[model samples]
Target: MDQSLKSPGQSALEDAFHAMFELTRTKPAPTLAERLDRLARLRALIANNESRFEKVISADFGHRCATETAIAETLLVLGEIKHAAKHLKKWMTPQRVPTALQFLPAKNRLIPQPLGVVGIIAPWNYPLQLTLAPAVGAIAAGNRVMIKPSELVPRFSALLKEVISTKFDATEIVVTGIEDDISQAFASLPFDHLIFTGSTRVGRLVAEAAGRNLTPITLELGGKSPAIVDRSADLGEAAERIAYAKLVNAGQTCIAPDYALVPEASVQDFAEKVQASMRRMFGTDPANKDYTSIVSDRHYQRLESLVTDAAAKGARIVQAAKPDDPAWKTKRKFPPTIVIGVTPDMTIMQEEIFGPLLPILGYKDATEPVSYINRHGRPLALYWFGKDNATRDEVLARTVSGGVTVNDCLFHFTQINQPMGGIGASGTGAYHGEWGFNNLSKLKPVFYRSPFNRLADLYPPYGAKISRLEKMLRFMS
Candidate 1:
């Protein structure tokens, strides 16, 4: 569609898309030096504006923890850039495959080529990492990139646009406006690939739109990712890790342990330990700098409704702080809460709890956790804390998830060599390090045939030679 005929935000998105699309068409493959330079510039952009990014991201969140921002956003992004730059050369090189004995002297090479113009639709939570991490791969793969950051983080989005614009030509890379009108149009563009990181509900819409253009998509969607506390696991250690993972960014993390499945005998003790850990780390104080506020009033209310519904349904409400206290609500910081005696009927159990709320459910035996998880949609991440190698291996083998982190929480995402993505409803496709580069590039297979081959003899009129050729093929098979 023409820019003049569309909404202002849509028009701007169209302009950016066309510009990068045209550039990619003209210069399809970017040299190794060019890719490394882009990665370096991106690193510098984050490094130079570390404080500014932190400040705006916090402002967007009402009050995000500075340490969390540094560790989760800035530091992770820097690590990705460093990793991509270091391994890009090897990733770009083609691999040789063995040729068939019948086609002697012929060769097979899988060449990696740039897929032009990759579009990224980033979610508000972990905005920086989700937005630029994919770009690192696209850039390393030699594709022009476009990003549409969430409108929820307007301050960070605007700043990102400003900084990215200064470092890159619009045709090389562009951060489009986050205005509402731009959103629907952004997904409809025919890009070589599209990546959307958010809830599964919206992921469906993005996937549907991308399907129309036959645009390949990578969805990093969230679901009710669970952490199982095995009978053999240390209660204190498991509680501490799950507590930190759940409360980080006030549990807005996509892979945050949505609930804990503990053995029936240890459920109460484990839940209390987790509550203690939450108090020890972030504390009950509404003004605690370590605690983060909910992103907006709407999200805050949704969380409140979940708690209220759970309480009304007869579940025990365990709070690190006084739940009725006005201080937490006033600051938009939900009191660190844990819900117990939760049944499948409760609203909290039905949906992805993207808040600081953790529901502790007891399992009858080791087999129950695996069976329960199997009954639901596949989750993006699953964590099992235990020392029992046999039991752990059984759970790992029986259930499927996008990724698994045994004995810890959220560490699977930090491994640069590993592919970070979800499976089924939680998400689709994977990317990080070489996985990202390969996902963004087309690994085209090229076969070289030698002129001296006699296979063409069978292509003519049928004769006794044809029978001989059939016998040879059968022998090879």
Candidate 2:
């Protein structure tokens, strides 16, 4: 692309990168007071504009419930800011470590320092939380940030850009909502560190682009996260919790339960209970108050294609709410759907169903679900619901996922102290609380020698004295 023809977003991103790079060269890391000031400004900006966030996000989605935005986007970011503010002092302190036995009387410490510039590519599902939560961590760690929010949610992105422009300087925290070409261009920049949260497909592109610059990256990619219901589990409570987690944001969350594994005999009963739970939450018609629409027509059609393909491939499709009338086609709202008799050959079974679709498969033993989860790439989140400690421990010990929630769903994400991220294809590295601070900072190691050090005897040409000392050490060993 020609430089003159570059989109404004692309131009601004290039400018921000240069500006931040220059700023960091002069002021490599902000002081504790400066960082706290930036965080305070961010908190004030979001807290004061809660209503605007709700309104803009609702406009971006056809009809997003205000409370959902309050809890997921605005409130979650606020919590992250408060948590970072409280812990930044401790997290920034140098950690003293014991020196190895070979280096007696030497001092060792790990000092945390900020990386120069960080780039965050946010996803559309939870735009505010994904975009600003990372910024909070970066600022707390004293790094400059450039955010490229998803273009699918235009109103929310514009509003976010406005908020950032008003409250933050470009070199401090820059935000952009650009076209795909510009996003690709932004991803190619040589940032000190970068974080991208989206599909594995696009995450691959971003990862490849960053790799060219040797930029360290954290890719929060999606996968088929599973929930297992052991035979000894409470079926009704499990169904209700799983339904609420899966249907929130219309199953747009990256960590939402993608499928459920139930004991063979209770499959039908569990499915019925999930249906009832959905009805209680969103009535028979799945009214707008609690249900959220698909983000775009393209995503809606892709979800529709998955359903049609699964149904054609001998899968039993069931709605969690009411009839799957065609009227929902125009409204862009899809019901919480359930699928049974799902086989690996079906499209729904293969892809990460990011919409309001759930597939329940039956397993004969506790080991089967573990084996199934192991066969696929590691998931971002896994859920296990049961009273049996043996089964819970077995699953936890056997399966590898980014995180786990027991007897419920998504509560693991709410714990700010724990790190949230994926392993293998799902994601790498974690970000939250103190972990977020350390992940974004370079913990440099320092070793100090005392003035009375006696190591000079071993430094020369390994003479008789060194040989004698080595022999004495060997005898002690």
Candidate 3:
């Protein structure tokens, strides 16, 4: 907040922001060929640097499964690239709009124009995917990009610098390492558009900073995402899907199932099924080669404390995997845990448990689950496991979240065609495919008229034609 503390680096950052604006404003708009070329270059960059990205993520996390990195990070980024490339032209096309009868002889259309430089602030979890995914959309919209990867993932951040520097011009796309001061300065810059992915606390800061400049922002933030399991749902399948999602990235994902609302009658059965699924997935030894470790010990300790505190408060702590289990004692490893009989006062129920701790709250009926979700601040994602179409529809209609998956979790985010973002407390704005392009571009309305058809009668001040035009407007209305 202090300008006096602003270092030369901060001054350079500001200059960079101004230079980007100048470049976008002064340079001729990119041709379709140039946009296509940029996409190709980005694709090549991701493909060529895939291995390096994986290695960097693995090094940063110290136990990130190579396969997980490839699937979650590499595949996701590549998929976004493919989606953006396939839809870029369609998204960029100026859409013709029907002119009102009142505005006769005029043609109107919505033109999609780039918003110049866009600043993307990415999160530490899934660092490569989150950072590059939005970048794909920003580039497809024909806007320059500046990326600030989280400091927690220093290795991947460094790798991004290398990859982006080699693949893109500084004025086109640039990646910067995380410095608190630099990040603050970067967020405060008057970018044409800014997209941030992080926690709600930081999202507020980013939104405030963007507000100061009257710049538009897309905030992708996380909250206590909940999974609802009804009486009619398949307990086994629901448990398996929930466990799989909860363990993915050791539950560091923004859209991971934070907790669950289960039918009271099926609570015990659901817990057993979840535990069985955990055992099956990790082979009773999650610390083995296949499973992932927590990103840091701090996260592990926080998870441990949450479990400890909940258990102390008379909540039932059900260990899907035991403490003596290989998964438990391993460095940065917290086994899939479930806390039942959880009251609203419990820590597990109150906070966004960004770990593999799934708290199950028993409910009397489907309505209770919907009510519970609605009572809480909307989450980044919501999950429902039910075969009944009516039940699924009911849940979908009743609950609000950034995204939803009918019988699974986190997969909805994979669909680039649909808009992905939070409502209310979860976050704001969406970015993916066409939505992402639109987020980074301004849809300016354009109107054209033929001089030959200009209506002179309506142009006169308070003439008899005005009454006639008013009648016509009333009729149209």
Pitting candidate 2 against candidate 3, the one with the higher lDDT is 2
The C-alpha stretches of model 3 lying farther than 4 A from their native spots are: 1-5, 320-330, 452-455
Best by TM-score: 1
Candidate order, lDDT descending: 1, 2, 3
Candidate 3 accuracy as lDDT:
0.84
Tens digits of lDDT, candidate 1, 270-321? 9889989999999878999999999998999999899999999999999866
Instruction: Report the C-alpha displacement of residue 162, candidate 3, in angstroms.
Output: 1.1
* RMSD, one per candidate, in order: 1.2, 1.8, 1.9
Candidate 1 at residue 190, lDDT?
Answer: 97
Of the two candidates 1 and 3, the one with more favorable lDDT, higher being better, is 1
Q: What are the models' TM-scores?
A: 0.98, 0.96, 0.96
Clashes of each: 0, 0, 0
Candidate 3 lDDT score at position 99: 87
Name every residue pair that clashes in candidate 1.
Answer: none
Query: Please, what is the whole-model Cα lDDT of each candidate in the order they appear?
Result: 0.92, 0.88, 0.84
Model 1 segments beyond 4 Å from truth? 1-4, 322-324
